[model samples]
Target chain A: MIRIFDIAAKDLMQILRDRKTFLFLLIMPIAFTFLFGFAFGGFSKGVSDPRLPVAIINQDGGDLSLRLVNLLENSEVITITQDAAKTLADYEKLLTKGNLAGILIIPTGYTDALLTGSLPPLSLEANITQTAGTTIQSEILAAANRLTSAVQTALIVGQTSSAFGPAFEQALSAWDNPPIRIESTSAVVQTGPKVSSQVAALAQTSPAMMLQFAIAGLLTCGAVIVNERKTRSLQRLLTTATRRSHILLGHYLAIFVLLFAQFLVLMTFGQLFLKVDYFRQPAATLLVAVASSLCIAALGLLIGVFAKNEEQAIAFSLIPMFLFSGLGGAWTPLEYTSATFQAIGHVTPVAWAMDGFKNITVRLLGFESVLVPCAALAGYAVLFFLLAAWRFRRVSE
Target chain B: MLQNAIEVKNLHKAFGDLKAVDGVSFEVAQGEIFSLLGPNGAGKTTTISMLSCLLRPDEGDALVMGHSIKDDQMGVKSVLGVVPQEIALYNDLSARENLTFWGKMYGLRGPALRSRVDEVLEIIGLTERAKDRVGKYSGGMKRRVNIGVALLHKPQVIYMDEPTVGIDPQSRRNILDSVVALKNQGMTVLYTTHYMEEAQELSDHIAIMDIGKVIAYGTNAELVKIVGQMDRITLTINAESGRVLEAWKKVQGVKQVTAQDGTLTVLADDSNQVLPRLFETSALNGVRITTVAIQEPNLEAVFLHLTGKALRD
Candidate 1:
């Protein structure tokens, strides 16, 4: 047996001396919170109005073609830029640089084709560089196709006006009616529901998970452990009365404290700057934060034990953490993805944490909804810690 | 019936097929500076590691301060301090902080820990640079801190494994002085080194080891006596002294004679009897000797005579 506090004190002082480690533990998490909170948090649940940038190069110098371009400019989804000098080359350049989403080319023969009821295939070029850009391009193409069909139908109806005026007028009025119907239905799909909040608390709680993974990948804990081993400081430590358990527990405790501080900073920034209602149930949030920190700390220990050097540890920790966070919906909320992908996210602790936070902040669910994830995270913590301890003992022996 | 600080009997440890320490046995009395002198890969480290309880011997038992390393590992570890060949101090921290951290591991705390840190810094003569980061320290300074960490626990027996391997002459002297100071305070030191001079100067009882076995073990004088009967003499004379060498070989107890480039070397049982005859023969043969020297038996000579190889080789 050895005094754990003594070891903890030393570990803390070492962390304080390393400036890079200090920034990783405390600063990086807050920066990530702001980054993901503003970028992806709003789109987690379905964005009702997305301002997608679009560009239109109108080659047809006709009144009808000009009217159609105006319609695209007025839509909420499309922020149309009109550049008469813009060519296919210029549009492609913009797409490569990520400055343009999709290009709309109204060919010179479009008006004549519509008049003669012989529609040429309108070229709707999409920037396939990113997934979001592709989705926007598809949506804009669909809306434009609908508008063209409406115009063709009107032209056909007007040509047959002399034969049946009253019947054709009724038909034209019916066709003039908007075909798309949007019905807002609030179906509360709560696994475990709470009465205090109308809006699902789970939706708001999802953003906090980005905070969790960012903190876990911080360089201090595992990097320091690997550094000690490489420098043979650990061998010197073994010569003393300090048990292996003391050294491991000391690092574990430091990671826990550092991650907890990171969680608070992220939550505070979330509530104040982003106006995210993460603190609706303070107790539930705190429970999730503490459990997540323990899980991440255990992960850090596993990295430290398995890695032969500091560089390897840092690489090993960051790569898996980044992948898991991205796949688990911490990088982009799991809600927007397919159900299969969401299920895959459950394998990651970050996904479990996101689920727990979503229950509290989005679904307004009680502690019951978070029980499974919290328990799973705790289980991971224990398993990782045991493995780390076993590895540490083996190396020392 | 002498009390021993450390005792190992028939110690054999095998890493797969290679026998690192094969049937090695030795004992060190209390308050004596004993050295295990061997070349690299000769199982000196393995033997010390097992005695320190950092490793377990496959087929032997070691008693460190009357505690069996196999049954009572914690007991052995509690009393033993190891200064490994590598510098193991933390590079990110200050020298003072590193000592304090190590001191805490030994159950020292608060003012006691602080004072001990100060004392160790003073002892290692690094008090002025205590606040500087260890990464900025020279190789010797790092080594001193490494030794300081081992001494923080104040163990009964300290194990130093080649502590002066790559250090300058000045740092090597400081380390040697520190070891002597600790021994004077009644600390039993098991110092291992390939440097014969270090072993001869510091070890009260020296165990000359090779190929995982102790070839010779005793006081320096006792071991030196093995080669004391043989006399080695060298004579530098004028050019072309072939006839002088032929006459010197005929002398009584002069076992071998070799001559090269105006120099003659002779090995004999008694120099006193051979010198008179050698002088007369050289004079009669008209070989004027400029220098004549007789070699005395030392650790280097004893090592060379026992193994047929120099200690440094």
Candidate 2:
């Protein structure tokens, strides 16, 4: 056991001594995270209006319909983009172009139907599968609830008071500053102009890049085994009291420590500057971090064992990094991809790690949400470790 | 009954159709220096590798300190220290760090590991530059660190595979002296080299190998006796000895005559009886012998006598 730690410590020191490790370890991830975030319309914090854009088709030209439009315009969640001359087809095209987050269709008699308490259904055209769609749906639901509360309160007051319109206005205004309000930062932001991206938030990209670069940065750690073989140190090590298992576990532990440290640094960066709230469910985030590190480190070991030289080591690590990151939704959200691709993405351990992290930061779930993802990551880690062990033996032979 | 520090029985290893280490065997008494002398592809490294547990033998086994290499590899390994043919130390790590890490692998820890590392640094004469990265070191300095790592654990037996191959004479001398020092401390040393002089100078027992087989195995004096009553003469001629070679073969007391690099090497039953005949022959061929030196039979002659070729060939 002491020998294992010594090997790991030695490997870590060797890797850390090279200054180039920092480029992928921290610098590239930070630069690319912010770069991709802005390019894909992920962040909109300091804009004139950070709210998501929505196009309104108000066929109901009544007083209630106008008031409802005003209510939606005043929402902090989404902005109203209405064109008096544009038809429904124009609004649909705007929504498809991603200039609008969604389209709101209020039918001609919506005001009278709602005033009569019929609670007629309103049509909302948006991608229910994406984060922006979920945000839009939540905001619209909250606004409709406010109006229903106002109407219900006014009806109860009208049974006794003759000034029902004034009562309704007062009740609607009461909702602006509702008691027991929860202030939450939605991970979705949209601009009215067409964007070639559905870049959701740092909450998604930060962890994704964290997983991706953790593998990319392994260009060094994964080469330790190959370097030892090239330098004949591994053969020298075998002559010591240390066993093959000792060498395997020791290297595995080192790679894990490095990857976990990278994850923590990137996670802290997301929490501090990107408002990703990794610490909101700190335990769940840590669980994912540990499991991901385990899986990635095992992958690093497998690469090191199979690679014949440093060049092969680079290819082994980089190729898998692309495969896992692309297939696992590390480059983009699984929701943005086809359902078949999304289903296939879960075949990679990265998808589970992403799910574990996004469940906390994006879905606003608790520790329980990360348990299955953690288990899946662990399963991948075990599989990779066994393969590495097998390859370690073969290479030594 | 007395047991040798290391025992071997028909150890063999092969790579495809080529036998790297053929059926070979030898033993070393406690506190004695055993040398495996051979040319480059003579399987010295492969034999040492099997004994050190880096390679498993295909046919036989060795016992290090009463532990069977085939059955108890870790046990054999625990009692042995190996310095490979190459400089196997991590260049990125300081000498001290490399020694310290390898020390821990041998199961030393805490203050013991540090002190052992310091002691090894002093032993290898690298204490001053112990903290510098080995990558910045000269080849000789790197070789010393390689030796130092093996000594950090102070195992019962040590295996050094041509530790002085690519270093300066001064560093080579220092390493040779360190091997003697380790022997003086009651440690068994298994040294491998292709240089006949190094084996003659340091070995208590010498094993001469050619093509994966030990052709000769004995002490310096015992092996030299194999070419008994025989003497080697190296005579440099002003001209190539190709013309005089047939004349020398016909001379009395001349056993074998071979020439290389404008020099004539003759193995004779007696140099006293053969020198005058060789000169008479050289005069007949108009080949002037510029310088002549007569040498008693050594390991080099023994290898030549047994294999009909020079040890360095």
lDDT of 2 by residue, A158-274 (tens): 665677666666666655643212222222223222333332466668888888888888879877779898899998988887889999999999999988998899999888887
Q: Which ten contiguous residues of candidate 1 chain B have the minimum total lDDT?
A: B304-313
Off by over 4 Å in 2: A46-199, A326-328, A340-348, A366-376, B235-244, B259-264, B282-293
Docking class of 1: acceptable
The CAPRI category of model 2 is: medium
Q: What value of lDDT does candidate 1 attain over all alpha carbons?
A: 0.72
DockQ, every prediction: 0.44, 0.62
Chain A TM-score for model 1, please? 0.57
After superposition, candidate 1 runs with Cα above 4 Å error: A41-218, B229-295
| Residue lDDT tens for model 1, B226-297 | 776567677888747676777777878786676655567676787888888888787888877788888766
Comparing only chain B with the true structure, the TM-scores of all models are: 0.82, 0.95
Top DockQ model: 2
